[model samples]
Target: MSAPRIIQVASGKGGVGKTWLSITLAEALAEMNRSVLLFDGDLGLANVDVQLGLSPKHDLGSVIAGRARLDEAITKYEIPSVSGAGGGARFDVLAGKSGSGVLSALTKAEISGITRGLKVLSDRYAHIVVDLAAGLDQGVMSLCMPGSTTLVVVTDEPTSLTDAYAFIKLLSIQEPAADIRIVVNMANDREHAWRTHAALTNACKNFLGLNPPLAGFVPRDDLVRDAIRHQTPILFRHPQAKASEAVRRLANDLLLPVPRPATIISTSSRK
Candidate 1:
């Protein structure tokens, strides 16, 4: 049997730490001896490479451009979670490619190739966390649509809240019943974070008739900033810190047992 694919982490606005969450979750899952693949699906402004401080020999853009094969473009990084956190398995990353000019339009054949590669990787990896670009791009939406779980990360600010609502609204229109998850980052405390979530949930219910699940809340901490500056995850840099502990708990809750689809049977099968 293939490994389980649960969630794909994303955000409405940029610079809200969605990428950081993705990296942390990947390491978190890997620490549990679960195979994790962190795919940089955010085509524009891809920074998984920058976050890890590793210069990739190739990137997904190259694969999309037909300039490099998928295997050749993928790079592996050694990310450490908390001490005695878990078994500490390995993590693979598909960095986003950078380019300009009229690259070949992503054709049907190319899309199929990419999807096939992702399915193969998903079969082996315990978790496939796709880091989508902020905003509502059709390409990003297509990639995010297949995810059985979706995480929407936001900050406790007016603009962040607005964007969060906009993102949820768009997704609800596209996939009305999608199980959207919410994460309020940079909060002063749990209460403040929950308030932000309440506002978001209320908006979703009032307008879109949906209530997104609260995946987790991360507190604002100097440790998070410090780790970012040092080019390491907070879990590794300050494992004992409160913010780090919260993130660890977030990861555990996500990786914990949950009911999944009984089978891959399609709508046509029921007929």
Candidate 2:
């Protein structure tokens, strides 16, 4: 079987809606008939399960601690059809143990183990969406392989732009040929989104000499906040919401053929 498309969603800072985008993007891809697994790569303080209102008995910590197999920790989430039809969207989630501190002290060997597990699991699904931890920490940098697409989520704030540049600068140095793309979340409009994208891209072009293209942008929508508050995916909670529509478009763009071969991360080599 062919290798799965590994899309790593990351950000320079927290509170930029990185996890939310990751969840919805996975759902959107699932809706397109591709089997997807949303792996919460935020090892230190994961909240993907909490945001989705899931109470999984097993999590990443279980696998790391030898309490369960990697596959055993997976929790399946399904959205029933509103019209009572048989068809609906569903995807699997490999949740992380929130506030467990297991990730904080994880050795390189343990990280490599998780990376190998993901490679083994790649055969079963067409896509693996890894929502990485915020900032350019070891956890985030280790998982950013060369062959996978990396979507850097940023907002209109100056701080967001600065930190995003820092991430891109480092990633470009580490994986010079990495497929890095920009995603503007909480944008005011298309124009506003482009401006935000330009700020990051210009900085990259000038300093890093690399211009990451814009993957897409999500508009600032109140419904997004409501969905997060209720621990429901925006696509399921408000299918007609602007944010939901934007995510669908982003997913569609991602479905296009990747320009490079798919490869897993080598955490051991990341210094």
Candidate 3:
């Protein structure tokens, strides 16, 4: 069996659709027949449950306090069919605590325990999509330091670009080996996305000496906001939406493994 891949969906600025990407990416992976887990990593502002209209009996708080097991905080979610079909994608959510005080206050031991819990549960799912808290806080950076695929979402705004660069620079300083990915959200068009990625990558390369790849981008679409308002992911609620289509394509590229070319020549003496 393949090892579980932890995909960390984070943003430099808030309101960049990180949460939206997290949920939809998990669903897309599940639809591709991969067991996926959408983890809410923002303990202080946990809204994944709210967005999904789920009230979990237990959450990360209970797990942190030893009142419940890690698995106990998990709740299953099945995305509604887009084509009005009977079947749809299903994934699990490890709900975080809402209004649970500042996440920065989480003790070192507590964070360690949470990390262990995640590692233990990793084997159960093919992909773990972590919805990390916005900004570059210590707690958020700690969780992202491991070999997780980090996708930094940014908008076209100046502040968004600046903060995104800062986030990547800090990550590069700490973990120079980390391969960061960029996804431009709310772009005007494909060219806008490419330009945004180019600007960010150029800054990182020139200053931080890091080269983060541009994964994909989602154009500005009112349907995205509509889906958010309805508390449903755009991919499921309106698959035809431009933003949803981009997200689906992003999911496919990330989850689907590319095949290597054939004809591997042997190094040893050939006949």
Candidate 1: lDDT over CA atoms? 0.73
- What TM-score does candidate 1 reach? 0.84
| Model 2 CA deviation exceeding 4 Å by range | 1-4, 80-87, 258-271
The best candidate in terms of TM-score: 2
Q: Cα miss at 98, model 1 (Å)? A: 5.2
Models ranked on lDDT: 2, 3, 1
Candidate-wise lDDT, in order = 0.73, 0.85, 0.78
Residue range 5-55, candidate 2, lDDT tens digits: 898998988889999999999999998989999999998889999998888
Candidate 1: residue pairs that collide: none
RMSD of each: 5.7, 4.8, 6.9
Which stretches in model 1 have alpha-carbon errors above 4 Å? 1-6, 80-89, 98-113, 259-271
Q: Each model's number of backbone clashes? A: 0, 0, 0
**Best of the two (2, 3) by TM-score:** 2
Task: Choose the strongest candidate by lDDT.
Answer: 2
- Model 2 residue 8 CA deviation in Å: 0.2
Rank the models by TM-score, top first.
Answer: 2, 3, 1
Q: Which residue pairs in candidate 3 have backbone atoms (N, alpha carbon, C) closer than 3 angstroms, thus clashing?
A: none
Q: Each prediction's TM-score against the native? A: 0.84, 0.91, 0.89
